[model samples]
Target chain A: AAGVIQSPRHLIKEKRETATLKCYPIPRHDTVYWYQQGPGQDPQFLISFYEKMQSDKGSIPDRFSAQQFSDYHSELNMSSLELGDSALYFCASSPRGSGRFGYTFGSGTRLTVV
Target chain B: QKEVEQDPGPLSVPEGAIVSLNCTYSNSAFQYFMWYRQYSRKGPELLMYTYSSGNKEDGRFTAQVDKSSKYISLFIRDSQPSDSATYLCAMSVPRNTGNQFYFGTGTSLTVIP
Candidate 1:
């Protein structure tokens, strides 16, 4: 079974720089969700898309933007990064028929801003 | 109060001991309950899931849901060192246009051999 895939397992950036993260959800999955987890904290929902359309939003910062492409893959673009933006970014996918248990997460991308 | 509450315990126990983790939520609208295990530097993986209420068991893991109390529990019997990880509780309403998940702070557990 293919799982969600996130690019740049580890990322290092300087404050005020920009970065972009990519996510490839499981094949056949329609919904993709993005989450950010800080040090020793629970994962916070950032945003979500269904069928390549923006479906929901969460605590995502104004400097960050995301979009799901026609291929069902998604990208998160962050600009003017800050130290606080350093965290683990995770992507999860689930098909429409699959319930909440269907959420399959990828090996997250660890972002470190200095 | 937060939507979900869980004790952030660095619980240490010897191997073969039973491990119990718990969480409480404030939303009655939630119908699906899930438990996820996260290893260091890895994303969370689903461990158990329950709908509505009652008890569900799978091998060494058992999950109990008390809808009336808005409480859920995960019990690992005969725990092993390999079972050591962070446990997170998540709850959500039925799947709809915009399904959102509420999570607890996660409890860290360590089982020593």
Candidate 2:
């Protein structure tokens, strides 16, 4: 079975720089969710999309934006990055846009802002 | 108050011992409960999930949910060193909302040989 795929397994950026993180959810999965995990902290919900439409929002920063395309892949765009942005970014997917069941998560992207 | 609460335990137990993990939530609307095991630097892998209040057993793992108490638990039988990892409990509501998942802080367990 195909699992959620995240690109740029590791990233390093200077403060004020910009970056983009990509996610390819499992095939046929229509819902995508983004989460940020600080060291020793639980994953925090950022944003989510269903069927290419923004469905929910959480603690995502104003400097960050995300969207899902028709192919079911999603991108997280961050600008004017700060040191606090350094964390692990995870993407999860569920079938038929229903998290009522559960989600399948990606390996995650480790972003380090200096 | 936070939506979910769990003890972050660096628990150590001997091999072959039974391990128990637990979490509590404040939301009464949460109808689905799940437990995930995450290895260092890896994604969280789903271990078990239960709807409403009941006990579901799979292999050596058992998951229990009590809606009335807003609590959930996962029990591991005959633990092994490989089972040493962080266990996170998660829950979600029905389809009316975004149905996003809320997670616990996680408990780290180490099985000694």
Report the C-alpha lDDT of model 1 over B1-113, residue by residue, as the tens digit: 98999999999999999999999999999878999999999999999898968899999999999999999999999999999999999988764566788889999999999
- lDDT string for model 1 (A11-86, tens) is 9999999999999999999899999999999999999999999888889999999999999999999999999999
Global CA lDDT computed for model 2: 0.93
- The residue-level lDDT of candidate 2 at B19 comes to 97
> What overall lDDT goes with each candidate model?
0.92, 0.93
TM-score of chain A of 1: 0.96
**TM-score on alpha carbons, each prediction:** 0.97, 0.97
Clashing pairs in 2: none
The count of residue-pair clashes in candidate 1 stands at 0
The residue pairs in collision within model 1 are none
Q: Which stretches of candidate 1 lie over 4 Å from their true place?
A: none
Q: Please identify model 2 stretches exceeding 4 Å from their true place.
A: B95-97
Per model, kept true contacts as a fraction are: 0.59, 0.63
